[model samples]
Target: MIRLVIIGSGNVAQHLIQAFQKSLVQVVARHPETLHSLPISCPVVTSMNEIADAEVYVLAVSDHAIAALGHEIPGTGKLVVHTSGATGMHVLPKHHRSGVLYPLQTFTKGKPLDYSTIPFCLEADKKEDYLLLEQLARTVSSAIFSIDEQQRLALHLAAVFVCNFTNHLYQLGADLCAEHGVSFEVLKPLILETAAKVQTLTPTQAQTGPALRGDTATLERHQSMLTQPYPKEIYQLLTQSIIDHVQKL
Candidate 1:
């Protein structure tokens, strides 16, 4: 049995805890600020000092604490992995076998994750630890990739642009619509379709609109329609990028 200890009770932790429970693995849930709450019955430890006898220790905490807590784990061989996409695997102390187990999808507390769909981006120092982590990951996710620390960091950077920046743009779109007396709900279909497209279509290949086609009249009309600087700026930048992307083809 791969005894697992999860070191945080946040959104990612909740998703992982449930996923592991569904697989019938022994798991310990703990949190720094809040009590671990899951209706599915498991040992919840409130402090780090209480942790004992774990084959795999998952540090699901924020990026800041990984180093310090990694220093405190008094062993040389525990498979200590963090659930951070940005932080490097070596952030853990060299005394222990370290790795990263970043789940590439956003997680929310109490919401069920179809673990089978979520990609596990895993990396480890030792071959044995790497294989163990991969096996454990495959139990929860069908897609498991053996990524290096460098590749994981690059993917994390790309995620910022794809997920984070795209969401920010959506916010800008919502605000632009609201100022024009348009309902935010009206953008919902476009949003859903945009997400669905990238699953099959390379985002650049799926690109559409006046900008990609260089319909200057419609582009001018879009700019003119935006009465405010914010939306106008976004329109200008993205349209220019689209034009560039289309020109490359």
Candidate 2:
């Protein structure tokens, strides 16, 4: 069994911890503070000093914390890896072998994920290190990709636009529908179809609307119905982007 010590116990840590445990990897220790209020069932430590030896130490902390603790973690020729999407593998402690094991998906505590379907973007300096990381990731995910630093950054940004920004748009749609005494569920089919089309079409190509058709009248009326803070500029900007896409087509 590969002895795995996960540094942080947040959502990403929790998910990874459970996954590692289920895969029969020995979870050596986790940071107590990272566990926070979550009732996580694992051996935890408040500091790195108390930790026993492990084959791998996973730094699942925030981007900022990775660099700080990168130097603090003791070296055992153990694989030191971070779960950061944008941060390079070299950001970890220099004495220990370093790598990345970023799972390109949003996570929430207790929300189950099918790891086998999730893409694990991996990177490492040495061939053996890369192979080791790849094998560990493959223990759960079948969709592991040997992505370099730059591509991982791009994938991360794309996720932000698709997941975070799209959810914000959904929230706005629900609020607007509520104000008009319309059921938000009415938008469910449209939302589902939009997501479905993306699996078939590039987001840019799948784009459709009054903006793409240059249907100014509908755009104006829709803009009129929207109130305060986010309507005018966002509508004009996104619509112009869609118009640009259509023109390119």
Candidate 3:
């Protein structure tokens, strides 16, 4: 088993600790209080100076802090990786064997997830380090892919569109429903069906809306109903995008 030292005590860190409990040797966090809920068996340290000897050091902190944290780690021989999608592996200290082990899924604290289904995007400075990262990733996930920095950035951008943007749209829908004295629960089934359809069918093939169909009357009616400026602008922009996509198809 690859002995691991995970840094940070946030959502990603906590999830990783649970997933790799067998291999975890130590957890390093700036605030010891943040790690109170962590496993008692695993040694927890407040600083990098006290970090245990391990084959891999996983920095599960925010993107802005990755480089600074990487610099604090004592050794250059061990593999040091971050769990960021937007940030590149180049951000880590030059002395260390740097890499990225970004999980392609949104993490919420206390929310349970099946790690097996989460795709792990791996990148490393060396081939040996890449293999080591892959081996470590397989302990939690079966879906692993060796993606370079550029590819990972592109994937992350697409993820923002598909996941983050889609969720914001759902919030907008819920707000509209609440305004009309309707329960957002009524849209749950539709949301589930739409998500399920994309599993087997292309998004363009599964697309069904006034924008896709070029139903001018319905589109105009919907546009007029949106009293808020921001939501109205978003609606128009997305509707036009859909229409343009269909025209190209």
Give the number of the best model, judged by lDDT. Answer: 3
Q: Give the per-residue lDDT digits (tens) of candidate 1, residues 1-249.
A: 467777777777777777776433334344434433565455666666777667888887779988987776666777789989889886898877898889998776666667899989999888889898888887888999988878988998998998899999899888878888999999999999999998999987688888877799999988888887877898899898887877777
RMSD of each: 2.2, 2.6, 1.3
Model 3 alpha-carbon drift over 4 Å, by segment: none
Model 1 C-alpha RMSD vs. true structure (Å) is: 2.2
Q: Order of candidates by TM-score, top first?
A: 3, 1, 2
Scored by TM-score, the top model is 3
Taking all chains together, the TM-score of candidate 2 against the true structure is: 0.88
Over 1-249, each residue of candidate 2 has an lDDT whose tens digit, in order, gives: 566777776678778876776333333334455445554455667676766577777888889889877677775577889999979876787788989999998897667888778888999879898998888887888988999999989999999998999898898889888888999999999999999998989877787778877788999898887776675677778888877767777
TM per prediction:
0.91, 0.88, 0.96
Worst 10 residues of 3 by lDDT: 32-41
Ranking by lDDT: 3, 1, 2
